[model samples]
Target: TKEHLISVEQGKQYMPTDTTQNSLLNLDLLENSEFSSITRRQFISKWYSFSYWIIFAIIIISYLVYFILSKRSVNPIEIRRRKSTKIAIKRLKNARFCLKNRDFDQFFEEIEKSLWGYFADKFKINSSELSKETIDLYFDKRNIKTETKNNFVSLLNICEFARYSPSKDRNLQMERTLEEAKEIIIEVESDIKKK
Candidate 1:
């Protein structure tokens, strides 16, 4: 190749210029060679293997996800209890909205709904069957903290009193009451879970 290049530089136009025999670089071409005879078998083997693994992994992950979700929600009663606080907090948010609008009556109504709905859902009891004594007995049976029960009673008393006699600090009182309502629901749920 060097000799051929030197001859070309010297204007030797008639000289044989076969450079492949002595060229410094090795050339690779796949056209019409052993490498280019690609069969569908090789391609399908790889493609099927990759697709099979991808499908297998998806199935396994889906099964695990389904198992976890189904196991968590298997028991309707347990699901109710676990979601009780979340549901109650949602109701209290509506109460908070009512409070923001200074709708004292609606605020109290929402508070009552939050508490009653929380207990009913948590204990799987009917709302109509929920009285002070019934709640006391439930708490006593579950051995919930006395202070928590007293706080619950205090929240009820505040709601009851506010409905009959109007208070001067109505907005502030309702805010405190809403917070207390949320706390009572959370406390009761935690106590039951603890047991």
Candidate 2:
């Protein structure tokens, strides 16, 4: 009886099955030439669309990486501070050389420039707007002593006067002025640290 039952099942296995009923081996789409062509075109179009989107995504990701890297390398405040300090020191050294060579006009001019450049860099003050009153107001707000503010302003005024007047006594005042200017910068730097 079992042998007969197995033979009947084997016979059913040899019978033809409906093409559309089997999802894995369905051939209806291929049998229709127009439908197969349309499906191939749709697949190609979808491939092109997916490729375009992938390219766009890659571009956006690269830009995001570039933006992050650029931002990571920059620190505006530290850059400004370092550059200003270097320039100020170089100018001061040049002024000292001028003093040693008895170049009064150049020495005064360098000192004035160093002070103005320092203020402009440190406070974002415009060069054209750098005046004694502006310096006084800025230093006063920072809690710098009245005497220190007066001394800085007075030094600037002296530089301006000596630049134009060509006084004979400028040589005598050069060393003292340089020292006072150095002291002013040191005091201001220390005050900034305290803040």
lDDT string, candidate 1, 38-148, tens digits: 655677788999999999999999999999999998999889877888888998999999999999998898898888788778778877799888778888989899999
- Give one digit per residue, the lDDT tens place, for model 2 in 57-172: 99999999999878866977656665776777788999999999999889999999988887777766777898878888888788877777777788888889888887667777
* Separate clash counts for every candidate: 0, 0
Please list the Cα RMSD from the true structure of every candidate, rounded to 1 decimal place. 9.8, 14.6
Please state the error at residue 125 of candidate 2 in Å: 1.5
Off by over 4 Å in 1: 1-47, 70-78, 193-195
Q: Report every candidate's CA lDDT.
A: 0.83, 0.81
Name the regions of candidate 2 deviating beyond 4 angstroms: 1-78
Cα displacement (angstroms), candidate 1, residue 88, comes to: 1.4
